[model samples]
Target: MTVALSLGATANLGHAQNTLNVATWGGAYGQSQEAAIFEPFAKETGVSIDTVTYDGRLAKLKTMLNDDGTVVDVIDVSADALNTLCKQGLLETIDASALGAGPDGSAAKEDFLPGALSPCGVASVAWSTAIAFDRKAFPKGAPTAISALLDTAGFPGIRALPNNARYSLELALLADGVPPENVYRELATPEGADRAFAALDKITGAVRLWNKAQQAITWLVEDDVVMAASYSGRLFRAAAGDRNIDILWDGQIYDFDAWAIPKSSDNKKDALRFIRFATVPARLADQAELTAYGPMRKSAFPLVGKHPVINVEMLEFLSTAPQNFQKALKFDAAWWRGNGAALQKRFAAWRARVNAARTDREAARKAKEAAEKEADKAAP
Candidate 1:
């Protein structure tokens, strides 16, 4: 049986709208969240739900939304894309009052964590950037700090890091002796770029850059690399599967995942109801438990206490515990939206340069081998 909230006088039960189109990533998190929360909510409210998964949500929004106005009525977006959507006027501003306002006729926005609520969206989950390592490789204790990953001399192992400029620049800055608070400010200018690149160059030969979550995790499990910076949720999945992996929250970047309603959605009322229902503390907690992502609702904390993310007692063994959210940087999505194309060109060129170097080295090796063979034959 499907469980749903009552559409009494407070809810607009008369409309009988039976459908909502939701957009989210298609993964463990996506599937579980949809099944546990969205599906149940639909059953309860009589609002049927459909899903669309896009690997790159910002790009997806651009493609799916023709600017004729309406696109998917509801979207779950990362903080980075959420910022971009807000600027592009692609999202609808949420009214807290209508969303079960706070006491004394005021809205209940305070129940959520700071910065979780937005004019156009509200946070659905919190994910952190953290280190995942092979526990079997280091049974005594996992390296507990981000700085530890950068210390090639002390912690000898192949490391995999993300190729994205947003988090990469911050990690480079952090490794280069720039404090977390000063990372973005320094990188905001040209000089900061020079410093960050110089720092990154030191570890270039030791690091393998990865574009996907699974690649990074696989590198750790396959013993291809000993340590990697990866999405926390991915690590959770890996650990759940008994990969002998452990995560360290040291210097991990935390980001909020938000749920937004399109301003142009024809089903505005249904969309709002869906958002409200999906975000209810208990329902959101269920999603968090199944997916191992952090819940945005303060009320869900109790429900999520048993989840790995909220396992305070075992936190010392976790990767994200040492992560300083205060020092961790937030990606400037608006800046990226404007400059992404140019930056992508630069990254592509950089990758090509690396490939070219490898190609040249291989060609030289072949020539050397041919010369050695010719000299031996002539001597004989």
Candidate 2:
């Protein structure tokens, strides 16, 4: 089932003999990988890592892996994508023994968080999608919970939500008073999907939908929105430069990203070596220092300290920090893996209805204005 890579494609022309091709989502995340993972791994093992950027498209990964000559050795994938790929037999099942030991000589399974060690991948970092608000817009009282994000009367202003249904439905259910623990359980049923969409219906007109993580941050920065559902890391970076932007950790949806190798990759050995080297507690902590994401390994928390460049402490901004972690909702990737398609279809239908309603409203307003102008001309 393995696809062979052409030697020319993988051979480091002017670099080290061994090369590992890694795929990641670009931007700050990519920079962090270069500084915290790739460079250090190359220095240690002489494996020159070639980084590529993608939009986390599973189809692209599948196509590359299924082709006769594939170049992607390792990829950074979201938990749900990892689950889907693993189910489809697209990714390699990593050996826990191949993963290096923790500082105290604990096994990889024992070292990583409860759900971190999957058959296809190991969790890299813990991140969250939380509510971020502009301080100047909400000078006195800001949103304190997920409920407030949906409550137009309580917190009146334009709100931004991700165009996708992933976190959107979960946040709606939470706002409707579904307990964090029961969110995924309830979402499994038809009634639960109805309730989530019903909650979303209330704020459809007031919400500005954003497709990109940076777009959400931009809306908050330009005052295009009073508040937005944002990736915690994006908001942290924005807040670092602009104090006016702040994140509300309450009801944040916490999830992890993992490093997975394509089943057909030719450089599985080098990829495994890099994964083992990069995921060790100290290296994981290094990643956290470079970005706002929390380290995946429990042991890494003890090692995480101040930001490497910024003078601020990293713990307070991390999703796994005690105060922030307490009220957060740990995303259920299993539920998404099982019910995602059906729910996505329902969400699409609901969105179409909302768009139609908006169009109707605009049409009515325009017709009324036209009639008013015509009547005034006749009177004159």
Candidate 3:
């Protein structure tokens, strides 16, 4: 039921608006980007930057392109989404040679990290999905390892997990003792996936599902859930503020977020100019000053200093930092994109089965209690 998109096709950018509509993430991430990238680009270029918030859903982008083809001028898409969009020809090609040179006068290509450059877009930042747990939940001890995620007895508490299978399956495998680097390779096989599901089965009744990134952190703070899988930046924001939570970087899944021009943009020229300006070493490092995401440019690494508000070192929290990258898993977007449809069907069926079983158990328990009550009445 999956179709491959035509890679070489192009879309038209309709009539121009006075301002460029740039679609991006919201929350602390958005605020950081506004300070580091958007505001600066707008101030210097004299072109108004009109922001549009989105959940990074491709279907929505597809619909916008199909409807008018000029609603959103630019976008901030993840590596996986960018790959699909590039194939669909929904994005304008970015000329790497035209990008601004690094502060050291190095060419953009040489300065960017490996896999950071693509025809789809220029990667802006590297972020991670790390486990953030409530500090007070574990009275016995803290869970410093990935294996503790599924060890319900060792770390007994309700959990919050994303409803999607991508991270869930991978984390389950890691908890089941799969070697860090071999996780994707192992997941590529039938037995590996089965092992992952079996691992998930061990903690069935204790999980609360979340559909959005915000839901994970919200549940951790407001609900009875003890721990959650969430974006590291969100966790950092929560921890930096009032949330009694700390990050567990073990088994972190790392990936990139990129700046891309939607082919439907009426202002491709302006979007490109903004992209070039925003990706400069100084601008990228400025983002790191505010959030936990690591700038995509290698030169930006050293320029990252302390968080201006908190006055703490920012490098340690970055997904690229040596200490954090040791056991980190690079998210295999290609694998997920390829197998997504089939696995989504399988995941839906599995969820149905799990729910049905839980419902049946509840019914049986209630029936047994009713019979015991009648027996006590008859005996009296």
Candidate 4:
């Protein structure tokens, strides 16, 4: 008997067995990963898979959960979004036991990173948020630590910071000499956020906030800004494009993108099957190669040296060196899920204040230039 699905479900419950839909963040990376791995799986399993873009995924998932018969099945999101979905009961718990099959018909769990094979989601890719500087612009070595980026007195140049409060604030605190391990605990209080903001205030005059990834990449490439805290993937692209950019692996923040099955799906088994195939080491490696993202599977590390996406030599300079990997502050997705909204409000207010100050400075400078020009004309 065919498995009974919720009425009006999007799952093809007919002769077409493996057809499914996947929701992912849109970009060249998404398209490449889909074509390389997900599309191939569709052909192998006789499934016709469709891919759609869902940016700002957490808010989208919440809307889908509230409405029944939502079409989304498999979703690719940041670790923070995954945790938020899991906590909101928007994602189905996955059973990895069913996915293991090998030469000896054993589970593939051993091939992946420990704690990564979660019941609700699995970290599919690893990438770093690091300090990237244009070598020609700075000429000196890239800023080594977060503190170095924060040090305007020594390193005087315009810098880019993400508009997001959580990670940005964490970096600010880290630059202020807050021990990495103590960052999260300290960020829990208003006083802590104040300190982070105050530290950031020192560089406020020198900062340009980048809200979108593409904008950040363009900024780095055009030398619009000398140095920006950006994703490792973007840095790879910049380096590959012959831009004289170097990444400071010291104090780099690492984050993961995870695959999750939404709880509102009509076909849990099919979703799990797709996720399993997607997470397979070979497939994961291919996706990483196509997307320039690092693979989460431990077995995929060796493949890293071969991929054009990674800077193999730069890997030696990683802040995530085995000893320091644990030292980097892991994003607290749970806190983000609970307090993200409020924090965003606070961040917006702060940003507005910064913008106003910048506007005033620019207006004053323009006024002074106009006055100087008028005086020169009158004297002549």
Note the Cα lDDT for every prediction shown. 0.69, 0.82, 0.80, 0.70
Better of 3 and 4 by TM-score: 4
- In angstroms, how far off is 69's CA in candidate 2? 1.3
Candidate 4 per-residue C-alpha lDDT over 53-113 given as tens digits, one digit per residue, 9 for 90 to 100? 7775567767765674557777888887777678777788876776644334456676566
**Top lDDT prediction, candidate number:** 2
Instruction: List candidate 4 segments past 4 Å from native.
Output: 1-16, 62-73, 88-90, 99-111, 263-267, 305-327, 337-380
Residue-level lDDT of model 3, residues 328-379, one tens digit each, is 7879878887776766676676666656666776799899999999999999
Compared with the true structure, model 4 gives a TM-score of: 0.76
Q: Ranking by lDDT, best first?
A: 2, 3, 4, 1
Q: Which ten residues in a row are the worst by lDDT in model 1?
A: 314-323
Candidate 1 on 3-59: residue-level lDDT in tens?
Answer: 343343334433235556677778777777767787787657666667777786577
Question: Model 3, 70: alpha-carbon shift in Å?
Answer: 2.7
lDDT value for model 4: 0.70
Task: Go through the candidates in order and give the clash count of each.
Answer: 10, 0, 0, 0
- lDDT by residue for model 2 over 1-380, one digit each (tens)? 11122343435643225777788888888888888888787666656778778887878767767874658889999988898899999899998888888889888788787678899999989899998888787766877777888898888877888887899999888888898899988888989988999999988777777889899889888888888898888888888878888788888899989999987777787888889988998888888988989877878888888887887778767887666776778888677777899988888887777677668767998999999999999994
The alpha-carbon lDDT assigned to residue 34 of candidate 3 equals 77
Candidate 3's C-alpha runs over 4 A off are 1-21, 26-28, 52-55, 63-73, 104-106, 136-141, 152-156, 179-181, 211-219, 222-225, 242-244, 263-270, 306-313, 332-334, 341-380
How many pairs of residues collide in model 4?
0
How far residue 304's Cα lies from its native spot in candidate 2, in Å, is 2.6
TM-score of each: 0.75, 0.78, 0.74, 0.76
